[model samples]
Target: MTVALMWEARAVPGRAAELLAWTEERARELTERPLRRETFRAPQDRVLVITWWDAPYDADLPELPEPADDLTARPVHRWRFESLGSV
Candidate 1:
């Protein structure tokens, strides 16, 4: 079954752009895996990262590269989803 993972974080003021750029580059490198789709969004002070995977696997996806010191607060929220047919 296809699965989707959502990662979200709050960027410190002007750090959203930098975090998005870094995540984009890192996400591209994961194309060789089950990754089917990926995108990043910056709304207000929050950055959202969404990725779709073809199937559940134990492989670890690429991590976002380091951002500027103090660019964002530590810890991020993540959610995983499994497609349950069309709603």
Candidate 2:
């Protein structure tokens, strides 16, 4: 099965660029993992981080830096797909 992890969060009012840079770095790091596939989309005031990986593989979601309280974090939602047929 393929697993997808979705996370949404709001960046500080004027820190969109900073958030993008931070996520880029994290994505680069995540790519080093054999089963990791990650991408991001920013819409309105939220950032959508989507990651796909093998069912049993481990994934490290990027951790916010110090001053972590600056951005609001949302609960993560995960789904597992048995096949890619419907996607």
The model with the greatest TM-score is: 1
Per-residue lDDT of model 2, residues 1-87, tens digit only: 555665455667767667666656665665334244555656644555566556543545333232255644433334433336344
Alpha carbon lDDT at 84, candidate 1: 82
Give, for candidate 1, the lowest lDDT window spanning 10 residues. Answer: 57-66
Q: What is the lDDT of residue 31 in candidate 1?
A: 43
Candidate 1's residue-wise lDDT over 17-66, tens digit each?
87777667676776455456566575666777777677664435544454
User: Native-vs-model 1 lDDT?
Assistant: 0.67
Best by lDDT: 1
- Poorest stretch of ten by lDDT in candidate 2: 59-68
Global fold similarity of model 2 (TM-score): 0.57
